[model samples]
Target: MYQKNPNLYLKNQVMSASPNKLIEMLLEGGIKNIRLGILALEKEQLVKASEYLLKAQDIVSELRYSINTEIDSEIPQQLIQLYDFMYSQLVIGNIDQDIKVLQEVQKLLTELLETWKEISVAG
Candidate 1:
């Protein structure tokens, strides 16, 4: 029986992903982290919550940086603003242990992920 290394498998997948697919993966990762953070917060595990929320924030930051403003200035600018808002909410939710804020961010990420999936499939 042969088992592939999980890390190597992930690296290969990432290497082969199209830009849109990469963005979709990032969105899914961010959403997963946010959900974990919320669960950790509910469990009164502040450290775990902080860690998960920070990962989600980092993903949002990556998405913001990946946007090409020169290609379409207005839309990219708007997306950057939305990402900034999500990052800010993640920080505040982690600090205050605010489940409501975390839920709001989760909703936004879900909507974005849905739209990204649609675009990826259509294009």
Candidate 2:
């Protein structure tokens, strides 16, 4: 019984993914961790909630960092601002034990994910 390591599998997937696919993966991860954070907050698991929120913040940060600043489009600036807002909300949600803030970020990331899917499909 040779079972693959889940972490290794995920690493391989990321290493092989295209730039657009990587964005999709990060957005999905952000949503997943925020959902986990929300559940942890609901359960009163403050430390665990903090951990998940931190992971979500890291994912959002990575997504923001991946954007190209040299592009003359307003989209990159908007994305940077959005990621900045999401990161701050994550911090506030963790500190205040606020599930609503986490849910807001989750919804935003989910919408971004859907937009990415449409772009990939149309491209």
Candidate 3:
């Protein structure tokens, strides 16, 4: 009997994912991190909150970097701006321990994730 390694399986899944799928995964990850950050904030766990928020910021940065400005200039540019705004808000939220800011970011991420899901289904 052969057992599959979870790490290897996940790597393969990511390697084989379509562009839209990858974006969806990133959005889901960002949303998860934001939710965790909000939870930490509510618990007054400043260090954990900062770590989670920073992780979410990093995910948004990855999303921004993955965008192809050459392919679709306007949309990618808009996404870049939106990601930048989210990153800034995450930074401020972490620094100030603001759950409200995290909530706003979470809402944006949820909407974007839903939109990406729709686009992926259509295309």
Each model's TM-score?
Answer: 0.93, 0.94, 0.89
Candidate with better lDDT, 1 vs 2 = 1
Residue pairs with backbone overlap in model 3: none
lDDT per model vs. reference: 0.91, 0.90, 0.89
For candidate 3, the per-residue lDDT at 68 reads 87
Query: How much does candidate 2 score in TM-score?
Result: 0.94
Q: Could you tell me which 10 consecutive residues in candidate 2 have the lowest summed lDDT?
A: 1-10
- Give me candidate 1's TM-score against the actual structure: 0.93
Q: List the residue pairs that clash in candidate 2.
A: none
Number of clashes in every candidate structure? 0, 0, 0
Q: Pick the candidate with the highest lDDT.
A: 1
> Which one wins by TM-score: 2 or 3?
2
Please provide, for model 1 over 1-123, each residue's C-alpha lDDT reduced to its tens digit, 9 standing for 90 to 100. Answer: 115578787788899999988998999999999999999988999899999999999999999999998884588889999999999998898889999999999999999999998887888
Which residue window of length 10 is worst by lDDT in model 3? 1-10
Candidate 2 Cα outliers beyond 4 Å, as residue runs: 1-4
